[model samples]
Target: MLMDDDLFSSRPEDPLASLARQDLDPLSQHELDERIAALEAEIARVRAHSEAVAKHRSAADALFKR
Candidate 1:
Protein backbone atom coordinates (compact mmCIF):
# COMPACT_ATOMS: atom_id res chain seq x y z
CA MET A 1 0.00 0.00 0.00
CA LEU A 2 1.33 3.41 -0.95
CA MET A 3 0.98 6.40 1.36
CA ASP A 4 -0.15 9.74 -0.13
CA ASP A 5 3.34 11.13 0.52
CA ASP A 6 4.87 8.38 -1.57
CA LEU A 7 2.58 9.12 -4.48
CA PHE A 8 3.32 12.84 -4.32
CA SER A 9 7.07 12.54 -3.80
CA SER A 10 9.50 14.79 -5.73
CA ARG A 11 10.97 12.01 -7.81
CA PRO A 12 10.01 12.30 -11.48
CA GLU A 13 8.21 8.96 -11.28
CA ASP A 14 8.45 6.11 -8.81
CA PRO A 15 8.46 2.66 -10.31
CA LEU A 16 6.19 1.36 -7.58
CA ALA A 17 3.72 4.16 -8.32
CA SER A 18 3.87 3.30 -12.01
CA LEU A 19 3.34 -0.36 -11.15
CA ALA A 20 0.34 0.50 -9.00
CA ARG A 21 -1.22 2.48 -11.83
CA GLN A 22 -0.66 -0.21 -14.44
CA ASP A 23 -3.78 -1.56 -16.11
CA LEU A 24 -4.56 -5.11 -15.01
CA ASP A 25 -7.61 -5.77 -17.11
CA PRO A 26 -5.64 -6.98 -20.07
CA LEU A 27 -3.75 -9.61 -18.12
CA SER A 28 -4.91 -13.18 -18.32
CA GLN A 29 -5.66 -15.13 -15.17
CA HIS A 30 -2.32 -16.92 -15.43
CA GLU A 31 -0.46 -13.69 -15.82
CA LEU A 32 -2.27 -12.18 -12.84
CA ASP A 33 -1.37 -15.21 -10.72
CA GLU A 34 2.24 -14.92 -11.73
CA ARG A 35 2.21 -11.24 -10.96
CA ILE A 36 0.82 -11.88 -7.51
CA ALA A 37 3.52 -14.45 -6.80
CA ALA A 38 6.21 -12.04 -7.91
CA LEU A 39 4.80 -9.27 -5.74
CA GLU A 40 4.65 -11.56 -2.72
CA ALA A 41 8.29 -12.44 -3.22
CA GLU A 42 9.19 -8.78 -3.49
CA ILE A 43 7.27 -8.04 -0.27
CA ALA A 44 9.17 -10.76 1.54
CA ARG A 45 12.46 -9.36 0.31
CA VAL A 46 11.56 -5.85 1.46
CA ARG A 47 10.44 -7.06 4.87
CA ALA A 48 13.78 -8.82 5.39
CA HIS A 49 15.65 -5.68 4.40
CA SER A 50 13.54 -3.55 6.74
CA GLU A 51 14.31 -5.85 9.64
CA ALA A 52 18.01 -5.75 8.92
CA VAL A 53 17.99 -1.96 8.67
CA ALA A 54 16.14 -1.65 11.98
CA LYS A 55 18.61 -3.97 13.66
CA HIS A 56 21.54 -1.94 12.35
CA ARG A 57 19.95 1.34 13.42
CA SER A 58 19.28 0.01 16.90
CA ALA A 59 22.89 -1.10 17.24
CA ALA A 60 24.13 2.32 16.13
CA ASP A 61 21.76 4.12 18.48
CA ALA A 62 22.90 1.96 21.38
CA LEU A 63 26.54 2.67 20.63
CA PHE A 64 26.00 6.42 20.33
CA LYS A 65 23.90 6.57 23.50
CA ARG A 66 26.60 4.88 25.54
Candidate 2:
Protein backbone atom coordinates (compact mmCIF):
# COMPACT_ATOMS: atom_id res chain seq x y z
CA MET A 1 0.00 0.00 0.00
CA LEU A 2 1.32 3.41 -1.03
CA MET A 3 0.54 6.73 0.54
CA ASP A 4 -1.07 9.22 -1.84
CA ASP A 5 1.36 11.87 -3.11
CA ASP A 6 -1.35 14.49 -3.07
CA LEU A 7 -1.48 14.13 0.71
CA PHE A 8 1.88 15.88 0.89
CA SER A 9 2.27 17.62 -2.46
CA SER A 10 -0.47 20.18 -2.35
CA ARG A 11 0.75 23.65 -3.36
CA PRO A 12 4.37 22.80 -3.96
CA GLU A 13 5.03 26.49 -4.45
CA ASP A 14 3.88 27.43 -0.96
CA PRO A 15 6.70 28.27 1.39
CA LEU A 16 4.97 26.42 4.24
CA ALA A 17 3.61 23.56 2.16
CA SER A 18 6.14 21.06 3.46
CA LEU A 19 5.39 21.94 7.05
CA ALA A 20 1.66 21.69 6.44
CA ARG A 21 2.06 18.11 5.21
CA GLN A 22 4.37 17.02 8.01
CA ASP A 23 3.19 14.29 10.38
CA LEU A 24 2.67 15.72 13.81
CA ASP A 25 2.14 12.31 15.40
CA PRO A 26 5.83 11.87 16.16
CA LEU A 27 6.29 15.28 17.76
CA SER A 28 6.37 15.72 21.52
CA GLN A 29 4.05 18.24 23.14
CA HIS A 30 6.90 20.64 23.74
CA GLU A 31 8.05 20.38 20.14
CA LEU A 32 4.55 21.07 18.83
CA ASP A 33 4.29 24.15 21.03
CA GLU A 34 7.65 25.38 19.78
CA ARG A 35 6.58 24.83 16.17
CA ILE A 36 3.46 26.91 16.70
CA ALA A 37 5.50 29.73 18.18
CA ALA A 38 7.92 29.62 15.28
CA LEU A 39 5.12 29.66 12.68
CA GLU A 40 3.46 32.58 14.41
CA ALA A 41 6.69 34.53 14.40
CA GLU A 42 7.18 33.79 10.71
CA ILE A 43 3.66 34.94 9.91
CA ALA A 44 4.30 38.22 11.68
CA ARG A 45 7.55 38.68 9.83
CA VAL A 46 5.91 38.08 6.43
CA ARG A 47 3.05 40.44 7.20
CA ALA A 48 5.45 43.18 8.17
CA HIS A 49 7.40 42.72 4.98
CA SER A 50 4.22 42.84 2.89
CA GLU A 51 3.07 46.03 4.58
CA ALA A 52 6.42 47.67 3.95
CA VAL A 53 6.31 46.73 0.28
CA ALA A 54 2.78 48.05 -0.15
CA LYS A 55 3.69 51.33 1.46
CA HIS A 56 6.65 51.74 -0.83
CA ARG A 57 4.55 50.98 -3.90
CA SER A 58 1.90 53.49 -2.93
CA ALA A 59 4.49 56.17 -2.36
CA ALA A 60 6.04 55.49 -5.72
CA ASP A 61 2.68 55.64 -7.49
CA ALA A 62 1.85 58.97 -5.84
CA LEU A 63 5.17 60.47 -6.81
CA PHE A 64 4.78 59.31 -10.42
CA LYS A 65 1.28 60.75 -10.65
CA ARG A 66 2.36 64.19 -9.39
Candidate 3:
Protein backbone atom coordinates (compact mmCIF):
# COMPACT_ATOMS: atom_id res chain seq x y z
CA MET A 1 0.00 0.00 0.00
CA LEU A 2 1.32 3.43 -0.98
CA MET A 3 1.55 5.89 1.90
CA ASP A 4 1.45 9.73 1.62
CA ASP A 5 5.22 10.00 1.45
CA ASP A 6 5.14 7.65 -1.48
CA LEU A 7 2.84 10.11 -3.21
CA PHE A 8 4.06 13.53 -2.02
CA SER A 9 7.00 15.74 -1.11
CA SER A 10 7.91 19.20 0.28
CA ARG A 11 9.81 21.78 -1.74
CA PRO A 12 9.93 24.57 -4.37
CA GLU A 13 7.37 27.06 -2.97
CA ASP A 14 4.47 25.48 -4.75
CA PRO A 15 0.82 25.35 -3.71
CA LEU A 16 1.87 22.36 -1.68
CA ALA A 17 3.36 24.79 0.80
CA SER A 18 -0.06 26.35 1.27
CA LEU A 19 -1.10 23.02 2.67
CA ALA A 20 0.31 21.84 5.95
CA ARG A 21 3.65 20.08 5.61
CA GLN A 22 3.67 16.40 6.28
CA ASP A 23 5.71 15.18 9.22
CA LEU A 24 9.14 13.92 8.25
CA ASP A 25 9.67 11.62 11.21
CA PRO A 26 7.99 8.69 9.51
CA LEU A 27 10.19 8.76 6.42
CA SER A 28 12.93 6.22 5.97
CA GLN A 29 16.39 7.14 4.69
CA HIS A 30 15.37 5.82 1.29
CA GLU A 31 12.26 7.94 1.22
CA LEU A 32 14.21 11.04 2.17
CA ASP A 33 16.62 10.31 -0.66
CA GLU A 34 13.72 10.00 -3.05
CA ARG A 35 12.32 13.27 -1.80
CA ILE A 36 15.67 14.95 -2.40
CA ALA A 37 15.72 13.69 -5.97
CA ALA A 38 12.20 14.94 -6.59
CA LEU A 39 13.06 18.38 -5.23
CA GLU A 40 16.21 18.54 -7.37
CA ALA A 41 14.23 17.70 -10.47
CA GLU A 42 11.71 20.38 -9.60
CA ILE A 43 14.47 22.93 -9.10
CA ALA A 44 15.87 22.20 -12.53
CA ARG A 45 12.44 22.60 -14.10
CA VAL A 46 11.91 25.92 -12.35
CA ARG A 47 15.33 27.21 -13.38
CA ALA A 48 14.68 26.33 -16.98
CA HIS A 49 11.38 28.17 -16.86
CA SER A 50 12.96 31.21 -15.26
CA GLU A 51 15.69 31.26 -17.86
CA ALA A 52 13.18 31.10 -20.67
CA VAL A 53 11.06 33.87 -19.20
CA ALA A 54 14.08 36.11 -18.68
CA LYS A 55 15.23 35.56 -22.25
CA HIS A 56 11.79 36.41 -23.59
CA ARG A 57 11.59 39.54 -21.48
CA SER A 58 15.00 40.67 -22.63
CA ALA A 59 14.03 40.23 -26.23
CA ALA A 60 10.84 42.16 -25.69
CA ASP A 61 12.68 45.02 -24.00
CA ALA A 62 15.18 45.21 -26.84
CA LEU A 63 12.42 45.33 -29.39
CA PHE A 64 10.73 48.21 -27.59
CA LYS A 65 14.04 50.01 -27.12
CA ARG A 66 14.66 50.12 -30.89
Candidate number with greatest TM-score: 1
Candidate 3 Cα deviation (angstroms), residue 23 = 0.5
Q: Judged by lDDT relative to the true structure, which candidate is superior, 2 or 3?
A: 2
lDDT of model 1 at residue 3? 98
lDDT of 3 by residue, 1-66 (tens): 998976685544566774348788998999989988998899899999999999999999999995
Model 2 stretches astray by more than 4 angstroms: 1-14
Candidate 3 global CA lDDT score = 0.85
Q: Which ranges in model 1 have alpha carbons more than 4 Å from their true place? A: 1-12
Off by over 4 Å in 3: 1-14, 18-20
Give all TM-scores, in the order shown: 0.78, 0.74, 0.70
> Model 2, range 1-66, lDDT digits (tens) per residue?
657875786656765786689999999999999999998999999999999999999999999995
- Model 3 is weakest, by summed lDDT over 10 consecutive residues, at 11-20
Model 3: residue 51 alpha-carbon error in angstroms: 0.5
Residue-wise C-alpha lDDT for candidate 1, range 1-66, written one tens digit per residue: 999989897768778999999999999999999999999999999999999999999999999995
Scored by lDDT, model 1 comes in at 0.96
Shift in Å, residue 60, candidate 1: 0.5
Q: Note the Cα lDDT for every prediction shown.
A: 0.96, 0.89, 0.85
> What clash pairs does model 1 have?
none
